[model samples]
Target: MGTSTRQLNIGFIGFGSFAQFLAKTMTKQGHLIRATSRSDYSAHLGDNFIRDMDEFMGLEHDVILICTSIVSVSEVVKSIPFHCLKKPTLFADVLSVKEHPRQLLLQEVPEDSDLVCTHPMFGPESGKDGWKGLNFMYERVRVRDEDICSSFLNIFEYEGCKMIEMTCEEHDRLAAQSQFVTHTIGRILSEMQLTNTQINTKGFEKLIQVKESAAKDSFDLYSGLFIHNRFAKQQMKNLESALERVKGLLEAKM
Candidate 1:
């Protein structure tokens, strides 16, 4: 789908680290933003903050971005007062896993409202510099008013993100092999307590980086990747089987 550059009033459902990171860029791009979360982030958002969910729905934003954790996405989406929405709005998500949110939004959101499931594929630490060359994957689950969806997506497209359009199923399968595997390795490194050494190899340093980055994120994020993505379970099994094969090879050599 084609998109045009247009300023949008975007409302974030959750104002955590990831949401804040995205808000910075959207604000820089001159999109009006408002947010409400379980905790009070009024100070952070200033006049844009709406304390009440009912009032938040009344704001009539062109897009409502779901920035909640993957595990809580269902509860969060269900809690939204869709009937209170002033108009048909575009509902988008930035969860790491795609299929879950795509399904939840499809089930929970009103039929008239549009749905776009997206994963930014970078976080606060990684995208701190800029979104240039970073991958942004999305699937247009349901869309009738295409212009609003395109305009909202343009925010990322304009920021030098490599916009990738694919089915949610395809995204989950690929992410299981790539993102899930990376996190699993990072968690394993963390478990091993891998640390810096005077003679750190280039490969070891990269592992350290992964371990640190992954450790910084909540276990909830990692768990959600495994629990929500069907393909991730197989990847986990593959990881264990690969290690076992390696162990058997070492034993044979011994």
Candidate 2:
């Protein structure tokens, strides 16, 4: 973590749920933030601009944190002035998938700044429970500034998250199994929509509880991950094969 939290002025690009949550968390840590707004070119998340991302990006900061959805990540990256970003600007994103956006960010960020792709496996809405199960997945490739990578890792580490590093491609391919498959299955569970009235039992109630929790995220986000991720498409094919094999086994059992 930066010993001088007061010196960490950050520019953020999006104003979604996780962005707002992370802004509050970083603000509590005493760092100033500027953000871009759909309305204004620059604005502060607090009084000066208060949720205007442009003002945040205009300020001098240690990092530019973009907490946008996976689909919007690249567009926001391209819109920002990469050349003007201060040296050692640690650019980090909290998007779910990595490879595509990570490549896009790398192309824009100069050698002086660091571009990191991170997937925070835990949501900020853990409330009182805190984040022990949460994992901060990251990658610090052969970029211009390695210290920026160190600084980025420090931010998540200080926030009580477990930091795991891998290449962006590896991260994306792996997430298909880790994140996409589970999410796809969870969506399947939610779509089933069976209730206790249909089958009165604690087991059924418990299943709904788990299923709803997994499916609690927006449908758009789910579609983005399941549809955009290349590995996810393959996994679904694998799933179809499994189901077919299982059906054959059941028929043979007869």
Candidate 3:
């Protein structure tokens, strides 16, 4: 990551593992980080954890980032006290599915607040070393305060992320074919209980990595990709058809 260009007072809506992972980098970049969640994260966050939702909203924040799980986003967003916001802030999300959070933020956030729907494709595991070359997709759904919005975006850019500017609908469509499919295959491999043997091929080793990576994340995240993204169902069908086609070709030879 490059030198921090602009410092932002960023507040988080959820302080889960992903959120905490992001907080470490943001703090390293010299941005002020404060957070509020359903549970107390004082042990993890120290004084940065705010237990009261209303007080968290009332604080001065240039950006309020929603880092909750995809399944919990709707309920969490609906419960936010937007009335408590002291000033117009830039509201962004780090959900894997874009369109879902995009529509919800647009509907729920205050009219004065700006909205930027984003999905940083890499997770803590993928980005543990650095964010260089990792994809960071974003859509500026609503933005009146361009400076604050740009500052928030610069955080990712400074980290050498391959910035991708696209619409929410387009993101979901492409992600279903790419990310969701990868996760599905990884989960399938994990279910098969495959393990490394004394004589493992290079290809088998790679498959083991995929299985391990998918197993690290919660099932809720995997399910949310299917349930929230409209295009995911079709991708699932494609995977099943491909498997059957390959099976048929082998059977014909036999």
Candidate 4:
């Protein structure tokens, strides 16, 4: 099955900023999009927006993409009327943390429904120009329908994203070290209210960029990075210990 030829019916579970960003590209590729969220997006999504959860689940969709926040995954997944589903659909999530959704969907979604846990490392800000070379990690936890899953994944591949297949645990462990640490540092920089100077070095300029980027995202997202990923706590400790070590070294030199 050629991805270019197949037009998929992709339904979004949450139509927030991120989901809307993804929908733009999917729509451009000629895929049909239907969305249902806590907030009404009728103006943005037009007639495609279904406000009722049951009715939304009743639709025939190739993929039901979960776009809720990391903190709300449990509440949202529990509320979904899986019994209302017309058929066994491909259930995938675009959450930052993988293992949470991977486990939740496996437990909540219908036994026949396929599950794919994915995290598109780049968001709207980063991928605004294009998704070329952006990292997209995914774990096919319980996928049985290969064609639909492949076609869905092809959306990223079509945009030149660097796709990586990894286990949920591995992704969480690595993300805590890399992404969580980056966000943590960025938030700290933001708290300091750092600004550029006329004699700013390239490194300082980069730090300012990180601060600005982190400030743009909601604090809920930052907190979720810490709260959801088990490995994040250790990363936080590591960051603190490293800072203390650097301070001790400077004091000893004095």
lDDT by residue (tens digit), candidate 3, 82-194: 99999999999999999999999989999999999998988888899999999999999999999898889889989999999999999999999998998999999998999
Which portions of model 2 miss their true places by more than 4 Å?
1-7, 39-44, 48-56, 83-88, 142-148, 197-206
- Candidate 4 C-alpha lDDT tens digits along 1-254: 22363789999999999999999999999999999999999999889999999999999999999999989989999999998999999999999998888889989999999999999999888999989899999999888999999999999988888999999999999999998998999999988989999999999999999898888899999899899999999999999999999999999999
Candidate 3 structure lDDT? 0.94
Give the alpha carbon lDDT tens digit for every residue of 1-254 in model 2.
22432336776677666776777766776667666656442333445344433445556777777777776666777777665544567778778888777777778877667677788887756633654546888876545655655655665666677778888778889989877877777777788875557655887677776677677788878887876677788988998899999999999999
TM-score of 4: 0.97
* Alpha-carbon lDDT, every model: 0.91, 0.70, 0.94, 0.93
TM-score, candidate 2, is: 0.83
Which candidate achieves the best lDDT against the true structure? 3
All candidates: TM-score: 0.97, 0.83, 0.96, 0.97
Residue 140 error for model 2, in Å?
A: 0.9
Candidate 4 yields a Cα-based lDDT of: 0.93
